[model samples]
Target: MDESNSRSHTEEIPEFVGPYKIEGPLGVGGMGRVYSARHKVLNIPVAIKVFFRDVNEKPASAKRFIQEARLAASIEHINLVRVMECGNDQDDHPYYVMEKMSSSILLEMKKNGNYSEREAIDIGESVARGMSVAHHHSIIHRDLKPDNIMVSVDGLYKVGDLGLAKLQDIENTSPGLTMTKTGLGTPHFMSPEQALDAAHADARADIFSLGASLYFMVTGKKPFEDEGVQAIINENYEKGGPDPGGLNSDLSAGFCQLVKKCMAYKPEERYQTMENVHQELIDLRHRFHDSVKPIHFDTCFDLAGTKKEEIERLMEQHAKAASDKPKKEPVNKLYIVIIVALLILLLFLLKYIAL
Candidate 1:
């Protein structure tokens, strides 16, 4: 939680923020509070992210809150959370309207321990496409993690908090002022360069985080883990991490290699752009599909049998059909002779007519 700088408060939550009637608090984080609300006029449900009163007092935090809205709004991609409106409330607290998502990727991870390789790849591709849009506009989502990746109501993974990483390291300098620090973003998913020098980190840093995220999704473990934050950072920045294939033996070599490339210690070695990562994931998916043979049911069976029993029977039938089918057979000599005789007779009759 980044609420270390937030001041304690006991005031009752507001019933409304402008035209939207506040339903309740959905989530509260270091950035601020996300409230579930509905527009009184349109009766449409929306999530409103509002800066804490203490956070709003700081100009630096306020600037970041506004920047997050602008940065997210600039990229009109389906895989990104849609920013509807942003401004200050009557009390001057910064707030932005966004489409209400069902939950965060973290929640999904908890509900279903580590997705299958294909599910992880599919989600990773969707997120990469979204980040590709941000990278194109020169905006790096310095903080890319499962928590920041939201699941839309429609089940699409949407990346949120695009520009808030810049403010994540803000320290409360005084009563109403905050100062940015050299370090920002989650330590678990930071690229080597990003962990070393966040201010200078580029799009490659996002690729590393995306890889780390996918690594977590498929393996159900972070790429690097330690009791101390510094220890984890050192491991990621220095030794990198273990081969994902070693942990998840079910993963193909190509998929494992692709993920390892993303977490490369050297930014230059990593995928140069989010587009490249996206394309690679797409290609990997294609390869995975091609490698697996589709099961074709030659005959429909009754539902009386168990699924496993039915599958076993189908396999047996397919194998018998494959083995019993003739590989080759000699052509009938009698048919060939009949064709030759007909041709000879037709030629003889034509010659006789000519004579």
Candidate 2:
């Protein structure tokens, strides 16, 4: 569920949904309200998303809601939220139970405005891993924003909220759920193709969204900041957002390049699969740990005059020079000295015999 949807309301909360006792409201989405709940028998904490009866009455909404639960529950990945069960209440309102997350990436961003480049990469990688699994299962997560990514108490990032997910295999059969040129997904994080036609968006679309999310994580700003939703969508479709490195000079060139590739205007230009994105993020994490250092505020002020390109070039040269340096061979000075002494002793003995 989206944390941004948390709002005070006058509606009475349900005491129980199926076998789980509803504790409190977690957040609300377009189709339903998420509540923190516990299993009556096991006392295990869980999150239950109860579909609004009015919305559930609609055939399209009902199918989409149930599909979301089924799709999420089918995939069993550590980085993806696990769905325990789904059923209808006495009032015929549909609800699905999932493992309750401690928090979300959205909450983390709210508490901490921006994340370090490393932190952003870690989050991106986790989400990519989850998306990779979904894509493998022919599921396209149209909405891959921070609000949909949850973080557990153990610091594990889990991808959730597949309410807008597109199933490639069943899309043709379910034309009602097929979003056409209307453009689904968050404007700021959606890909150009998705903005044009969400129904046609493939795995690369999710890659673009993930990239945009990473951009937001590191820069503390939306990829495309516009006055309105349509303008934001236009910016994403016509012109890509500004460079992440420019927004946050602390970001490394490699990391910025990764984001740029992910946010490519054309789907073909973006990473072909979530696996590719995951691998690149893994590589970036390794590079970050091996050589990259987080730029501090003091360091930024110290090198205020230097351009990012110059710093990157210098670092590249330094790394290259270090790698290209030749190793020195060992020398035996004692052996050389011994040989010289023997030669001198032989010469002196010959001279004395001659005398």
Candidate 3:
């Protein structure tokens, strides 16, 4: 057998991609292989995804892949996965370099059935923030499943896998455009319109997928799910989802309403923007926390700005800029309130102690 044909899909990675040393295989899929690599001087860990070394691969496919990488590398949002660099190997196998994040995905977490209502809502909103950034750049994360969402060490999410996502303003929208014929994305998370007419899908498709993800987080199962992809598509075109409040008997009606709104059959009926979806999540989380009444907001903000790149970059690196800005004194309003309340209790205690 030919060595090329004999190589397993999960074969060991080469020593280097250009200059970066390929440490090992990270993951693999039908499209290509991802490897853990290291920048020689920078020592930065990056995940490099590469296509198969096939010279006869479709021109459009390769072109679209490269374009997506380039576009993704330029978009600088904290919530979205950052593409540090991109290039093609000697065999014309294109690859991208990206910061390697902690690889915990929501898909794996959903299996445990431990998602509280507030956590589900927060996940939905965090993902929406990333989606909004992509939408702003005229890009749609056509594949918005939990596997594509990674939570970093600092507990912030960075949306990954822009490989299948389409840029709306690109020339590929014109006639004779070649779309991914089969399995462009995960069937479980696709919107009805996307399942039916993928090309016609826009940002709204992402909103529906986010709803599906949230549904899984909330209910621990897919609504309108099926054993096969075709069946799933058919079910999606019809009505969708488990009866929210009825299933869990723990979800609030307001949160259920929001989920249903996100899963609207028509794009027009769903969330108009990701920002709106995010804001709803924010409000819902706050409401849930309010009922609990013992939130440690101080601890939450203790290591504040630890995960924010822009803040540290401008504030620390550029001393002049930080000096120019008026520094405001830190105020602990919550602690002050607590102290005042404690003082009132102490006064009552004094009278009781005296008696």
Candidate with maximal lDDT:
2
lDDT by residue for model 1 over 1-355, one digit each (tens)?
A: 2343232244357898878899997877566777899999999999998778765677767776776787788778899889999877778787899999999888988997888989988899999999888777777788899998999988898898765443222333223222223546788787767766676678888899999898888888888867455776677667764578878998998888888899988888889999999999999999988875334453545434559767767667776777778988889999999999999999999999999
- Among the numbered candidates, top TM-score falls to 1
lDDT of 3 by residue, 1-355 (tens): 5443444353656788866889988776445677889997788888888865653287766666676687688688888888988877766578888888776456457546547787777677778888898899898888887778877767887788887787775545544343534446778888777777677688988988888777777677766648666788667557654356656878988788888888887788988889889898888887887665232344345445566655445444445544576988899899999999999999999999999
lDDT of 3: 0.74
Off by over 4 Å in 2: 1-10, 292-355
lDDT of each: 0.79, 0.84, 0.74
By lDDT rank, best first, the candidates go 2, 1, 3
Cα lDDT tens digits for candidate 2, 275-304: 898999899999889887334344444565
Candidate 1 lDDT score at position 80: 87
TM-score, every prediction: 0.81, 0.79, 0.75
Task: List ranges where model 1 is wrong by over 4 Å.
Answer: 1-11, 163-181, 298-355
